[model samples]
Target: MEWLVLLLIGLVGGTIGSLVGLGGGIIVVPALLFFSTYTVILNDISPQVAVGTSLLVIVFTGLSSTLMYMKHKKVDYKSGFLFFIGSGPGGVVGAYVNSYLKVDSFSVYFGIFVILTSIILMFREKLKRKEKVNHFPFQRVYTDGEGTTYTYGFRPITAVIISFIVGFSSGLFGIGGGSLMVPAMILLFGFPAHVAVATSMFMIFLSSILSSVTHMTMGNIDWELALFLVPGAWVGGQMGAWLNTRLKSKTVIHLFRMVLIIVGFRLIYEGLAQ
Candidate 1:
């Protein structure tokens, strides 16, 4: 019964994650904290296990959504590859250090990430409110209407720098990595909402893979439960892509920011609870 509930939750999480380029952690983590709390074998320890297992799960989730994004011509390979370069190594280093962390330490770390994420996100929203869209970079990206034209002559440099920061954070936190990538791409670099979401998913696919490998090498991955999760993640990814087809990007972005804020407070509460 609990597995059934998690599968349903994974579906919704994947759908929401696909739409927003959030890498699905937004859905999985919260469910572990609140919803999955009702289930057995996942009571108090669910949050920690869920964070790990979800990262392992989203490798497939990101891959599926990434392929869909590619089909739609939403991928920006130049930037995506650059971001992967840094995130991959960072994930390895992060996993190696995971063993040193205690639950209290994780709570504190999560609190810091939540606050930093919220601050950056709040700043981005402020910029959006004050700035003109016409001045945005990458204005005529993706399609040229008559042709499948794409351009990234220099965007990868800035994106790579940002990716380093995002990847480092991901490795440190065990997050899917999009929690930082999506906002960094959009507000910092002015990527189109669709492109940012799509590319972030792709980037996370790499980061998460490396993180999983590192964790697995260190014997941190739980293969039995991870296998149980694959189906749920697959269903979720497809549903998320479908949802993205219908939702507005701004609405999705705003909602994601809200989740960041709530998660930030939740982490802070947990950290202080001890």
Candidate 2:
């Protein structure tokens, strides 16, 4: 029964998360933290362990989603690589820092982060404006496997700074960092929605690998439950990626925003109650 619940958590979390490049960590972490049976079943359950397990699960979820995106050729390797360079080290730092914080403190901060992210996502469309980028360092033109072309420019230095911050937050909070990356890519760096989603997945793949490894060393992961969760995440990730190819960019953003809002409220409630 416990295993069954874990599987379901992974499935739902992976589907929604992969669709928006969130990597399902938001879903998994909260579920583990609040589920009625979570602490009951796992005697050693802590917020840090919950977060660590989520990160480990994201490793497979990100891989599955990335492969699916690769098939569609939506990945922007150059930007993805730049994001990874900064995020990798940041993830290590965040994971280590987690050892110093209490669960309640982390919960409050996580709630705040979720709420802020939701607000930004909600207002992003209304804030969209035409801006000219004349001197960004990284410029790219690429065609996806579906023959859709995207042209965009971004500053490498800016991307690295943001990616590092995103990585740090992801490692500290046990998220995939996609919640931050997707919005930054679109709103801050002027990336197309689909490209942002795809590239975010690639970045998540890189940073989560490092974060999960750090968590492993800290004894903060639950391997027994991860065994149940990973399968569901893998299957759901592929499904979500496939659905992404068929949806319009606006629809994807709307869905992503809705998820964030709902999750954010729940997180806030949990933090206050604690």
Candidate 3:
């Protein structure tokens, strides 16, 4: 039953993460911490272990989703690599920082982060992008499945700096960092929605690799639990990428925002009570 629950958690996390480029870690990490702390099913799940395991799982989730998105030609490979420049090192730094946090403090900070992410998603659509002339060094033109062309660009240094922050959050919290990156790509850098999501997943893949490696060296991963989670996450990643083409994600996004808020408050309460 515990194994089954873990699988389900992976499935749900991967699907939503892939669908929105949030990287399923947001779901997986909290679920692990909650179950381990509140129930007998999971035992002794420290924040470091939960985060490390989540990052490991996100590697597969990102890989699976990126592969699916690739078929649609939405991923911006060049930009993804550029972003990785900062994110990779930042992930290492974040992983080191994670070691210093206690359970209660981790819970409170993570809860706050989750709430902030929810707020970002909630208002992202309403936030208007300022019109500006494109003079950035890196320019990209993308054509979606519907044959609509979108042009976007960003300064290479700026993108790397942003991705570094995103990567740091991922390392610290075991999230995919797409929650932050996707929004920045769309609102700040003028990336098309699909392109932003796909590219963000690519960056997640790369950053997760570096973060997971750091976690591994710290001996924070639970290989037994990770075994159960990876398969579901893989399947869910594919499912999400497929659904992205067929479904209107507005409803899903709304539902996800509510879930984040609920989870965020619960975590905060738990930390305070502890």
User: TM-scores of all models?
Assistant: 0.80, 0.90, 0.97
Best by TM-score: 3
Better of 1 and 2 by TM-score: 2
User: lDDT value for candidate 1?
Assistant: 0.67
Model 3, residue 236: C-alpha shift (Å): 0.8
Give lDDT tens digits, candidate 2, residues 67-141.
Answer: 999988888988899999989998999999988877667777787887787676676656442245456777777
Model 1: per-residue lDDT, tens digit, 106-182?
66677677667656655654443112335434333566335754332235456666677666666556567776777
Candidate of highest lDDT = 3
Please give the TM-score that candidate 1 achieves against the real structure. Answer: 0.80
**Candidates' C-alpha lDDT:** 0.67, 0.82, 0.92
The candidate, 2 or 3, that scores higher on TM-score is 3
Clashing pairs in 3: none
Collision count of model 3: 0
Model 3 spans with C-alpha error above 4 angstroms: 127-133
- By the lDDT metric, which is better: model 1 or model 2? 2
Tell how far residue 238 is off in model 3, in angstroms: 0.6
Cα shift from native, residue 25, model 1 (Å): 1.8
